[model samples]
Target: NAGVIQTPRHKVTGKGQEATLWCEPISGHSAVFWYRQTIVQGLEFLTYFRNQAPIDDSGMPKERFSAQMPNQSHSTLKIQSTQPQDSAVYLCASGRDRGDTQYFGPGTRLLVL
Candidate 1:
């Protein structure tokens, strides 16, 4: 079964460090979503794309967080100057379209110390 793939299932970074998370969406899927899960926030939507173009990122942090889809196969989420509060499980999901059922990756758990 094809599914979204997330690299570096776990990451540990010191405060002020930079963290980059990678996601590979299911082949042929046109929509991708990024989310963050934390004890305080629970699950929070970060961004989403359609046809490899950003559709919305209003949920993303104004600073320090950025996401990009340079191609149809992959997307990346980067956090600059990572703080302890940035620690969370980053999730990636892919779907054929915005309304389609999204398949999620195993997620990457990041810890900032």
Candidate 2:
């Protein structure tokens, strides 16, 4: 079984352009998480879902960045009017639930110029 799949391993866009990233969680895993990593903030939790329902998203920016789990197997992160400061490695992970260990996928590296 594929542990997790993150599409578009690398993305580059001009400032103000939009970028969308996709993540397909492992089969049977109910919890999916999104994170952003940068030199300043390090690894920070962005959002998560359990049984396809959003649970937490306190770390996410109020605007431009959003994450959603449409179904059990896949989720998406969308950023609108992206800026250079938005460039970072976005990670997706899946696990049984909050207390269980989550498996991380190779992060999607994004660059905004």
Candidate 3:
């Protein structure tokens, strides 16, 4: 509900295709969630959620990227029309609550060709 980042650690897709990444937060720790992207520019915030309700996704590209927390156990990040620049390590992290201890998962490495 709060934290878990997913999809694939290494995802290779062709340009103009679509890609969906998933994350599963730890059980009983679904109060706050956030996603980050690790690219050449360094890590950047992507989105955040509370109680599975979207709070902020302003970091995502308005045109092609979207994220969702459909349930308490998992979340997803979907990219429409994949592009070469979309390549990066997408991270998933969650916490029991805002300002609480957070845990991180292995990033899903996306390589758009």
Candidate 4:
């Protein structure tokens, strides 16, 4: 398996701009997770997918934050009207089951200007 891959290792966006981050999970894995990491908040769960369906998104922001699992192996997270408060390391993880240990990809760091 290829583990997990995340593109655009770093992103810079101006205030009010939009930004998108991509992720590709390990082959055959059915669970994927998104988390945001910052010095103050630590790691905050954003959303998750199981069997290509969203299972939980309770941790996601009510506005401007969205996540999608378009297929079995890939997912994306988009942030609209990017703000300085949105700057963080966006991490993608995947595993065979919800309780299984997840393998993390090198995160995409977003910097809002």
Candidate 5:
């Protein structure tokens, strides 16, 4: 299989712009993971899905961030009203099942001016 695929490897948006990141998981993978990387947070687990069902997303900000795994093969993370603080590398990963080792995609880097 083609591993995980994340589109728009890089994105730049002005403050208040909305950013949408996309991820396509590996075939037959039932678990998908999302992470955000910043100097402060290092690597924060934002959300995850098991069998295309959202499992947990406690790390995501309640107001401006949302994640969706509408199907087994793909997921999306959308950030509304972006700001400079939102600039970070968003990573997508997929695994066989819960607690399994997740294979990650290259990543989508967001730059907010």
Candidate 6:
């Protein structure tokens, strides 16, 4: 029961550089979700994985956002050519099933310069 862990709680990136965020979900949880929280967008769903397979990614930006669940316990969100508009809190959550309540991590806050 290590809970969810997200690295570098805060990040600053150049206007056109790559930004990578990491998340380690709770053990035994099979569903992982990514979301972007902003003052304007509220909570924008990014993507999700179930049993290490991508279930949906319709909420991700078409240009530079991508997410991967390489294994059971960890996932990553990568942004290429980051821009000011990308500045937001990236959150990771996990649940036992699709309809179960998700537990959220502290989130990684990104600031694009």
Query: lDDT of all predictions, in order shown?
Result: 0.96, 0.94, 0.80, 0.95, 0.94, 0.94
Each prediction's number of clashing residue pairs: 0, 0, 10, 0, 0, 0
| Per-model C-alpha RMSD | 0.7, 0.7, 2.6, 0.7, 0.8, 0.7
Give the Å error, residue 80, model 6: 0.3
Q: What tens digits encode model 6's per-residue C-alpha lDDT throughout 1-113?
A: 76899987999999999999999999999999999999998999999999999999999988999899999979999999999999999999999988899999999999999
Off by over 4 Å in 2: none
- In candidate 5, list every pair of residues with a backbone clash: none
List, residue by residue over 26-72, the lDDT tens digit for candidate 4. 99889999999999999999999999899999999999999999899
lDDT digits (tens) for residues 1-113 of candidate 2:
87799999999999999999999998998999999999999999999999999999998899998888888979999999999999999999999888799999999999999
The CA lDDT at 71 in model 2 is 82
CA shift at 66, candidate 3, in angstroms? 0.6
Which ranges of candidate 6 are over 4 A from the true structure? none
Residue 85 alpha-carbon offset, candidate 4, angstroms? 0.3
Residue 22 in model 6: lDDT: 96
Residue pairs that clash (backbone atoms under 3 angstroms), model 2: none
Candidate that would win on lDDT: 1
After superposition, the stretches of candidate 3 with alpha carbons farther than 4 Å from their true spots are 1-5, 32-34
Per-model TM-score, in order, reads 0.97, 0.97, 0.88, 0.97, 0.97, 0.97
Candidate 6 least-lDDT 10 residues: 1-10
Q: lDDT per residue, candidate 5, 1-113, as tens digits?
A: 78899988999999999999999999998999999999988999999999988899998999999999887778999999999999999999999998888999999999999
Output the worst ten-in-a-row residue range by lDDT, candidate 1.
Answer: 1-10
- Model 3 lDDT tens row, 2-111: 33556577889999999998888888775545455654668777887788999888788899999898998888889999989888888888888878987888889888
**lDDT of model 6 at residue 62?**
86
Model 3, residue 4: displacement in angstroms? Answer: 4.3
